[model samples]
Target: MATEGSNSPLRFASVEASVPKITIQFCIQCKWNLRAAYYAQELLQTFSTSLGEVSLRPSTGGVFIVTLETFNQHSVLESHTIWDRKRDGGFPETKELKKKVRDIIDPQRDLGHVDGKKSATNPPAHPANAGHTRELKDVAAQVVDGPVKVSKLQDNRPESLGVQLVQAQNSSKSQDKAECEDCK
Candidate 1:
């Protein structure tokens, strides 16, 4: 018969052997593929041993979502979203993304200098001649203002269901206006 001590080690080993899988999906329509891939690379680099796999799925309609899936006995035990663009509004910073993954993978693990309070309060010193620096918010605004080539026939594509829905709503509004004008 296995003693309590032996069972403890077995239980611990089983728990340690199971690592969660992470999937990050980004909207191709929103031009977020590069951003999603970057985040996937960062997460894989940071939690290589703790993560089972990291997948990048292309989607549409401004979707930028990160999900974690835990498995037990060859079946998914739990699945949850780490972030959603519709809820969070924008891409997360690299450090912030690291923190989120760390929280889920190893809650007790310390991120050393990355999680220090001073690191949060002070900006890292840069070389004097590094040229003008812009805040993240400013850079984000510039990216938003940058021209994006939007295809006029996107509504006809199956991947652009959200675009189709928006077009339908707009046409219904135009039809209502036309009917009201006829009554006048």
Candidate 2:
């Protein structure tokens, strides 16, 4: 098997293109498009290295799968584009993981409630919410004609001060009329 001063053409090609490239192939059902994209993003992060890059260019010819590149370090990825090099490998489709992501991106979450309260965990409440509270109250006031009152809010968190003030003013006016004894 010894050829003097000659490398086989195939061997030469292999050597010339020695930088390992990995092509990962998997079937993704088209129905779950959102889940598919999320999985792709998570998968990319796992394999990203400063050595080169791991990229997924979805195929246009109906063959849809993700590929990874090893930069040809012995090209161990020839068989599988599987890049979980760690002993404790990462799998994307564990049942528990799916549930957690589903909960986080819940589709029906009310935007106002989720982003309303200021908390350490939440991003600061929206800055342009200055007129929101008043708008909400005004909308509510349209249907219900019951006296809407507001109470003093100086020492407490913001609470209604209008209705209470109206009642007090009415009471004081009635008392003045009663004391005057001018009209029954």
Per-candidate TM equals: 0.54, 0.24
Q: What TM-score, to 2 decimals, does candidate 1 have?
A: 0.54
Number of clashing pairs, model 2?
Answer: 11
Clashes of each: 0, 11
Model 1 over residues 27-82: C-alpha lDDT tens digits?
Answer: 77556789998999988877787888899998766678998877646664777788
lDDT computed for candidate 1: 0.66
Best by lDDT: 1
Scored against the true structure, residue 176 in model 1 reaches a CA lDDT of 33
1-184 per-residue lDDT for model 2 (tens digits): 4377777543433334322233333222222234446655553343233213323433222233433333225544433333321222433453333233223333243333233444456576576665556755664564255544544433444544332333322223444332211112
